[model samples]
Target: MAIKPITGMLRRQAVLDISVALGLGTASGYAWWYGYHVPAVRHRDQFYQKIEEERAKAMGQQSS
Candidate 1:
């Protein structure tokens, strides 16, 4: 049986694909944690306050 050699561009493309997949997986995990797990841990008032604080901080940073 003969072995086939992969070209340089193909190897580069495979590396890029793997990097993209890893990045997307990390983002999805963060989204799930914030969207579901975080809310479940807090009471209503506390949760709203946390959200408000985050929003205010973001806006403050944006304005600067």
Candidate 2:
């Protein structure tokens, strides 16, 4: 009777929650992988290279 309807509603809500959580997690992962991780890695490499070049120049000056 009433118990059946309540059970059905709870089951539906649980399914909806799971669906939304999965969707959010997927979107967040994609954003991090494509938006942040790739460009950040590239920028980090470039930054380190610049630092190394500057260090070498400073060392050359001191040696000269």
State which candidate has the highest lDDT. Answer: 2
Find the 10 residues in a row with the least total lDDT in model 2: 1-10
Task: Give lDDT tens digits, candidate 2, residues 1-64.
Answer: 4555445888899999999999999999999999999999999999999999999999999999
What is the Cα-based TM-score of model 2? 0.59
lDDT of 1 by residue, 10-61 (tens): 8899999999999999999999899888887667769799999999999999
Q: What TM-score, computed on C-alpha atoms, does each candidate reach?
A: 0.52, 0.59
Clashes of each: 0, 0
lDDT of each: 0.91, 0.95
Candidate 1: segments with Cα more than 4 A from true spot: 1-6, 43-64
